[model samples]
Target: MSHISTINPATETTLETYTLMSMQAATDKVEACHDAFLKWRLKTHDERANYLKRIADGLRDRAEDIALLMTKETGKLLQDGKMEVELCAQILEYTAKNGPSILADEERAHSAGSKKGWVTYSPIGVIYSIQPWNFPLYQPIRVLASNLMAGNGVILKHASICTGSGLLLQEICNDAGLPENLFQVLVIDHDISDKIIEHERVRAVTMTGSDTAGRHIGHVAAKALKKTVLELGSNDAFLVLEDADIELAVKTCVEGRLFNNGETCVSAKRFVITDKVYDAFKEAFVKQMQAIKMGSPENEETQLGPLSSKDQFETVSEQVSKSVEAGAKLLCGGNPTDQTGYYYPATVLENCLPGTPAYDDEIFGPVASLIRAKDDEDAMRIANDSRYGLGGGIFSQDEDKAFRLARDHFDTGMVRINSFGAADPNMPFGGVKDSGYGREHGGFGMKEFVNAKAIYLP
Candidate 1:
């Protein structure tokens, strides 16, 4: 237990072993990051932005190798790995291009518009980032790019499964001429992680994971009087209205459900269809789900890959089994293949009632939950029934109506109309309720941990 072994989930082979660092060593790294921040904060916003662009270039230069390492460690499709790397670079470039204005000091009117004043965003100290393994590069880059632009040092404690990805990220940043110790990666367990939050130097924390874990981290950081941003996962619902384009609905649902091997946080997990089009949507969705070929991540033609780990595989399988025991009906897949890897087939479950895992929980796999609604109104109601509000989607031939519905009715943070997506560097990311609070991306993340000081002159 003292050493963490990285495994290739597809082949179930150990790729490398990393020893957990002592508490003293971990704290030293944190202290060093704080030292780096002192000098980093002295740099102008434009100076930090230049560093961000250089880091973006470094990511592209090594995209192939980083993507391959990601695929070997997490069972993500190689092509998807390449896309993730590109997405991360795009985020950095976007931040660099827009950061100067976003973080710029602005003149203001004060004393009832009779005097001059200004507002400035000054950097805090080290910010700790705890990210998941699903999108190893994208997750950390989103946090690192914005914070570094805001002149704050960052320390990432990546998911244990993607430790190598985290270390490689640090090297890339350094190679781009980032100031020494501006970014560091920690290879430690949860016990040491808690202590890191309690460290006197780490100014704020950001984590993306389950609500259960979010609560624990929130409580720990709160006791220390530190601000934290939590992006807990969601069981997003994609609704098919009565007038929805049946063809569009089917295609979008299939792609949304199976993307990232169906382990995405904002990916569609529940399908709520209006009774009028329920039959047609269900038939087409099931046929497409069954047609997907599950195979090795290295295969170019493979549509589905293994889950991230054996424990994740067992968790999804058990959720399906218990959902059936609690009255859910299975439509296509309910069992694992005889393959050597931890591969689960594209699964569908209907008759999903309340109090069952299929209806109430976020199943982090390629399983889709179907629920019937009386009409479009009922479908909207069903979509908002869960405690999560990360993101959702609506499929309809009436684009205007769909836009209005998404803008006015959907209870989630982000909504897709007649289509599907993962993340956008230009849009605000994060969610509400148990899906966690606060926002990232766009211009919001640049100010999340910054000290917004107000200055006045009379």
Candidate 2:
């Protein structure tokens, strides 16, 4: 059997290696997961909730070890790794607390006057999730927690870099009282993954990755007529309105751009500032970005860490160079540091044109793109001009106005007002346009892979 080596992105060293499951073995896993789903779906939501709560407890119990492992595997900051564990725990708890009602049958009105109608949510077979390396645990947990509560079995094909994290998570769930084979990790390559998607036992697919990956998965699943929920990449815009507070905007923007070493799908990437506050916001934002400390993710004092791998480092470096070549002004930090590891400094670029990567593409690293707008209306316009609409934010002193803009004008799946946050368990998260489709969390995910059967009684 072929083997896959796990590399520690921070140190560029091999951490562990696992033999890839053969295609036959992958098919066997699908059958096992489907069998588990048949039994698991018979359990009531409350019964399944117990397992979720225990899973949360298991996460907390192993939080330290899991966080450290993830930091070593993905190069996310140590603190961020811990927070990811907490977020995973919170997702489990949230689904446990709210899932019963979310999945409960709903009484419906019949088209004909005399009949009583109702709708029931029933679990399908296995759901295959393809997740990325960033936010390793939370990404899978976001899908698994809701599916488990909904009585569906889960299978994960995590990014190669985070295979260890995926295996460990499956182990934790099993140890926390999840039935064997209910959630399996497929340690296989893309070819085998594609075959698994076509397996009759695998009912649905969900993915959190780049736009290109999303397209490929969506196509493969579509060919099989399988349901897909993809949370793809985004160049989410953070609009600074004319009346925005410069200090608050600068601080929040800096935090948003550099969080997770600037490798988040929904983090604020494009800064569209109204001309009134453009110079002030840019000056302060660049200063804060420059002041960030870059070093090992293990260092608590380091605000920025290396990209997840050498490939990512090269991609970000190349994107910056191409953007600068395309006439974008490099305000600060356009170069990689001399330090070892896949390290890139906090970078700020201005005068980003429409065609360059800085303005149009998702720069998945510690680089900020600044765009000037004529006014508040123009800033809103600029924010909506992107092909991606995963999540965006508005920075203004007037909360009511910002809320209106987000609610009415922002064309994204999730919106933030004067703040920076990747996700919350209470909110529905996903994206629009090239960012892919379907929603997770806020009670929506529990129903995604379920069969919503409508019944009529006379």
User: Per-residue error at 205 for model 1, in Å?
Assistant: 0.5
Report the lDDT tens digits of candidate 1 across residue range 107-194. Answer: 9999999999999999999999989999989999999999999999999999999999999999999999999998999999999999
After superposition, the stretches of candidate 2 with alpha carbons farther than 4 Å from their true spots are none
Give RMSD to native, each candidate: 0.8, 1.0
Shift of residue 100 alpha carbon in model 1, Å: 0.3
Q: How displaced is residue 408 in candidate 2, in Å?
A: 1.8
Name the lDDT value of residue 141 in candidate 2: 97
Worst 10 residues of 2 by lDDT: 107-116
Largest TM-score belongs to which candidate?
A: 1
* Model 2 agreement with the true structure over 208-304: per-residue lDDT tens digits: 9989998999999999999999999999999999999899999999999998999999888999999999999988898888899988899999999
**TM-score on alpha carbons, each prediction:** 0.99, 0.98
